[model samples]
Target: MATALQAVEVIRDLRHSFNIGRLQMCRADEWLNALLAERIDSGEKRSLRSSGGRKKLQKH
Candidate 1:
């Protein structure tokens, strides 16, 4: 769940990376994956911090 700002930033980065990849003749998928992973990890860290480092358990 990326915020609006984060989403916009991702889009901007994607375009930049795409152009660089094209100029360098490299694959964009790898770059895209790394960027997405970084964003996800950061989002997880933010959520954890917001919850005071305590996660609630769910019952099955």
Candidate 2:
């Protein structure tokens, strides 16, 4: 069995690999779904501001 410290190190490495910088814009919905399902590492909860002409992703 792996030690606790070793497991933590592996998790940290995996989290680094899952950072948003690694994905393409075309996969945003897939990423969002995975994030909602707790399958991805969302570093923080930040709001995305929609431009004046663009429709927002959420329904009010």
Candidate 3:
């Protein structure tokens, strides 16, 4: 899991092309969750679920 400081840094880097101040106004969990959800939806990433749960995970 990312520390709050690390998450902030990530959000900062991602905001380089946008409004940093506005980006900073978002809650860290909200940003992180959205990023993860996007990656998962793209089918380019493996779910973090254990192998035993992977079959179930694929239902998503």
Candidate 4:
């Protein structure tokens, strides 16, 4: 499993790649979810957006 910091780095890199058109949106989403799964649960996804949560380890 990747550490939360590593997951954040992976997410940032994937977003950068997508912005550069090197990665399609679908592929970027897949990669992000895959990396995030190492730390985040599916149920926490909504809270991340809804609550404006920045830290991955924060409560949902």
Candidate 5:
């Protein structure tokens, strides 16, 4: 049926869009990590709070 075909097309489009969005998120996370790595100091301790939880990167 025509209606069923249309529904399939819409679902395909949505899946493609979701994949693109996930790729963008991965790139953004990589960029942010690179930026953070540059500002961290070897002598001091700091916590990086992200979506999962807080992680201790260094010790004072």
Candidate 6:
């Protein structure tokens, strides 16, 4: 029946749109995670440098 075919088409379209939105969200999450990782890495490096300086000063 035409009505059944139309219903199927609508469902297919909705599923396709949902998948696209999901993919976009996944990409955004990846970008945010990468950004956070970079910030954490830099913070660790800064802390290490400061700690090393303190150790040297204490020894002297």
RMSD of each: 10.1, 15.0, 9.3, 7.9, 15.8, 21.4
Put down candidate 1 lDDT per residue, 1-60, tens digits, no spaces.
444345446766876876654644344445645644664676764553354333411210
**Each prediction's TM-score versus the true structure:** 0.32, 0.30, 0.34, 0.32, 0.35, 0.39
The residue pairs found clashing in candidate 3 are none
Question: Model 1 segments beyond 4 Å from truth?
Answer: 20-60
What lDDT would candidate 4 get against the real structure?
0.57
- Report residue 46 deviation for candidate 3 (angstroms): 1.4
Query: How well is each residue in 1-60 modelled by candidate 2, as lDDT tens digits?
Result: 443234445655665787635345326546445543442133222222222212222321
| lDDT tens per residue, model 6, 1-60 | 222224345655765777757776667556645644554575644543345434423443
Comparing 1 with 4 on lDDT, the higher-scoring candidate is 4
* Whole-model lDDT per candidate: 0.49, 0.40, 0.56, 0.57, 0.44, 0.50
Candidate with better lDDT, 2 vs 5: 5
lDDT of 1 at 55: 48
Task: Rate residue 50 of model 6 by lDDT.
Answer: 44
Measured with C-alpha atoms, the lDDT of residue 52 in candidate 1 is: 37
The best-first sequence of candidates by TM-score reads 6, 5, 3, 4, 1, 2
Best by TM-score: 6
Worst 10 residues of 1 by lDDT: 51-60
- Higher-lDDT candidate among 2 and 4? 4
Ranking, lDDT, top scorer first: 4, 3, 6, 1, 5, 2
Which candidate has the top score in lDDT? 4
Model 6 weakest lDDT span, ten residues long: 1-10
- If both were scored by lDDT, which would come out higher, candidate 4 or candidate 6? 4
Reference-based TM-score, model 6: 0.39
- Clash pairs of candidate 6? none
The superposed Cα distance between candidate 1 and the true structure at residue 3, in angstroms, equals 0.4
